[model samples]
Target chain A: MPSSCDEKIPRIEHHQNNSDVSITICGYWSLNSRERLRLLRRWESLVLQWKDVLRFEIKCDESLVWDSSLVVFLRNANRDLSVNGGQVVFLDLPAGLNKLLNLADEGQKRNKEQKQDPPSDGFLSMEALLKPLDFLGALVISFLNLVRGRSVMRWRDFFASARNCSASALPIVTLISFLTGVTMAFVGSVQLEKFNATIYVADLVSLAMVREMGALMVAIIMAGRTGAAFAAELGNMNLNEEIDSLETFGICSVSFLVLPRTLALFVMTPLLTIYADIVGILGGLLVGTLVMGFSALHYLEQTQSALTDMWEVYSGVSKSLFFGLIIGFVGCYKGVFSGRDSASLGKSVTSAVVISVTLIIIADAFFETAFSLLELR
Target chain B: MNVSGRDDIVIRVESLDLAYGNHLVLKNISFEVRRGDCLVVMGGSGCGKSTLLKSMVGLLAPLRGKIIIDRDELWLNGDKKRKETLKKLGVLFQNGALWSSMTVFENVAMPLEIFTDLGVKEVENLVDYKLALVGLAGAGNFYPSELSGGMRKRAGLARAMAMDPEILFLDEPSAGLDPITSKRLDDLINELKESLGISFVVVTHELASIFDIADDSIFLDSESKEILAHGNPKDLLKENTLTKVRSFLERKTVNNS
Candidate 1:
């Protein structure tokens, strides 16, 4: 006494009408006609034991629903029959025909209404404003949560994150920092040699490296390279619902994912700044001794004396720390707040890098202003 | 056999309305799930099945109405209350959303590490036990990408079961799987439901999986965007108010064969 009421059409018979198309569904039913009607109303599609046929009753507003030339598509491995209703169509089936008819009525009503009121705005424009707001709110919450959750350091996780962010970043950071050093020395040599202050080039390079230039250069570089990457990786994961899945498993998405990367960048950024400082100074020294005709010893002597202040060193380190926080927070924020799709991830990552780098530069300007006003440098 | 009764009611979602702009995804949807009961939500794509699941979990807030879990009204907002509600449930996503970077052991152990005061050894043992429960004992060291589709699903199941939640939500757990594999996963779901004594609300359009495991189910009509019928799957197929449900069930049986 299975309750399925199935109607079967012979496989060999294809119903044809003068102008209207015939749709046949083959199946079997155990119920009586009245019960069959109830069951068919409940289930729009039928299940048959052997191959069966079903014929569709078609009507249309445009008279195209009854077109005999319409294509019949077999889907789901010949289990589904799809009829395309070109302009307008209403098909009488077991259950859904009534609903379709109602929809058609509704459409007709809307069409009439649209004609009456032509100035009506479509719904899509509202969505445009709301989506970015949604994204921004999620981003702010994600960033604040990460900050409040734990310490900005997780040693093991930092090591793992650093391997991802810093280790691969070494060659590029080194190259840029090296070039900065060479450029500084070359620029300084031209001016110093005129005053017979050729040896003072070391002093120029040292002062800039220790006080502001080294950290600024490295921070900007990391923001472009690693900050964007963090966003792309984490944002892609978020889009995939991976972060939500973690939450469902009773895992904190912020602690498990965000903390490690933030802590890693916090540690790595300073080390990278220090590395940049060394490379830049050496480049300056290379240009001074080789290109500017100053002795290596003379350049070394000036750098040693001019850059020995602890406060100068501290300033460079402190700026790196602040820069790291900015990049990490912005990158992780973008990642966790990414919408649930690939296109959203791409946009988030792009914004993460652009916003982070811009913020870092602004903060650097603030640093310059503070140091100058306070006479700390 | 342990069966669910009235007192076993776990989650009750009442008069839920969910919308994004003017597009109403779920309209006044209401349903109840009891402890030790398997409630399946069967619907086509864009029929608001997943949206309903998300609302119940408090991941997506309903535009109107309430969700009560174990007779307690779970807050859809407020940080403290949300965390408390979250602890009572576990979810397995459609794609097995395992963190690709972490090994299976880490993925399963994540919850234990986060919410518990357990020591390292105890956490490890707990993780291993959960993985073993899902029949993935020695595969703990493998990353998610290394596992096959079925194996990844199993790992996700293990992770979901790691916390021994009072309620479980699975989104399309058998999607994209072969019939045999899908059946195997459904069998695992059934075993977990019986053994854990936890309520399960699974969102799926896979009729075979639903019929095999569902104790009670709801069918969503795509065109009308409403609950066409709700009851035991077997009974619904027999005496549904909507022709769509009967047709869908019949189609399911034919295709599975």
Candidate 2:
């Protein structure tokens, strides 16, 4: 069947005179026609055999029916044959083919004529290493300007950021924190039950929530939700030249835009951490009451005792403030410096969330060690 | 450097050179925008006409030379002083660049609010007048997203005109607009020039608008990264010393016509 199909393809007949060749093509060459690649291969082999040919003329039949595929093949063939100072000239071709072939030639010429602006280096370029530090310097300047009461920020923008990272973020934080607490209690209860100390599940759940899980979970949540939003919003602003307008007006973009957003996250992260801590403890209390058959008051006593050292709670809350700043900072930095296209803007948003989450974990480790060394743990 | 008593010189660029990273753009561009003169910066695409405008308007720091706006060196001064110098300049960016978040009224009123001690009623009155001046009398309540491209450009011009700066640097004012719409914008620019005596430093390739608004003009060449010609567009057309400048003007007109 493939052999039968090949015989029905367009025919190529050539008449050669010394270094010059004229090839005549006849029949249909639509894009979907089968065995077109075979015909192209045949054409290629013929040109390869006539490597010394100085000029090849292409003559299309009066009844020829072809498409862009033929034009592309001819374009490449023309280029190949012309590589050794030879020329490919189309003879008696249809008007459309002539124009299309000319257009291909003209486009190449045009491309060569114009100086190309190199595409932006992708996400992991060397600039990425120093971007955080550059952003940090700008952030410090903005912070100082804010301290001096010279920052340009809208009160409502801060409220909007707070609302997004806090009020709207509450439901997800609740679900995650509660499930985490329940999971810890279930695991700890099973292990402690073997030794007849299932009551220690309450201590384990409350201690984890107070010392680490609470802040870390909230930071990761905001990183996905709030961090992504900040990146997208500011990236869009950069594309629209809103940032440039502000700068040309002599208004510092970091002071006007970044400060309000980062400050909102800084102020709200700890508050959300506390709320999550309380709800998570309630989740453990439920597990202790139902699964372990302990009174709710007894579970509360255990959690309270476990959290007796206020610094354990303070340790998590303090970390959250830094967590929030990191999220906002990374998002705004990625956005304000985003490239001038939708694809780059999207990449900026994704990287903002990723960087925020990664930085949050690393900073958490740093703070954890610092607290332990200072005897606050 | 010394304009002396020449009130004619509003903007003076002395051998300005600009770059992006290390790629050179404009080189040794020296020109003066006289008071009340509509100076058009005309060139082929990618010729750094807009880059030159950006440098003059305090957006890009030049690699060499100075941009003196009304006798104050723009880049040499403290940022506070640069900002003080900037206040004398209003810019209408390509694509209008209106704060999409703000209504047209608020967009125009913002500069007045931030840079002045005007009362609310005064700001409202001034915004209304500016809007009316651009023929967007009832469009003040609309956001930039709600307006057509031509109206957006008009709103942007209104904002640029809000501060009533000495020089208005417009980067491609007629871009992406229909011929009729662009003509209206050009006419509006002429109206403002006649009424308020504002100096215009417009960067555009629109031949019609160039002829319509430009009292003086400079042409930048991409190959040399320098100004190829400087004069009135009308005068330059008659005696084009270089074929490139002649073709730049003629080809655009031919294509449009």
Q: Which candidate is the best by TM-score?
A: 2
Return the DockQ of model 1: 0.20
Scoring only the second chain, what is candidate 1's TM-score?
A: 0.92
Predicted structure with the largest DockQ when compared to the true one: 2
Q: Candidate 2's residue-wise lDDT over A4-51, tens digit each? A: 223446667789999899888777777887668788878778878898
Off by over 4 Å in 1: A1-155, B1-6, B222-224, B252-257
- What docking grade applies to model 1? incorrect
List TM-score (chain A only) for every prediction. 0.62, 0.88
Candidate 2's docking class is acceptable
What is the fnat value (0 to 1) for candidate 2? 0.46
Write the residue-wise lDDT of candidate 1 on B13-101 in tens digits.
88878865456777777888867889999976778888888777767767888888776777555755776777888888888888877
Which tens-of-lDDT digit does each residue in B1-257 have in candidate 2? Answer: 22456567998999999998778898899999888889999988989988888888888899999999988999998778998899888899899899877899998998888778999999999999999999999999999999999999899899998988878989999999999999999998898888888889999999999999999999998879998999999999998868789888887322211
| TM-score, prediction 1 | 0.75
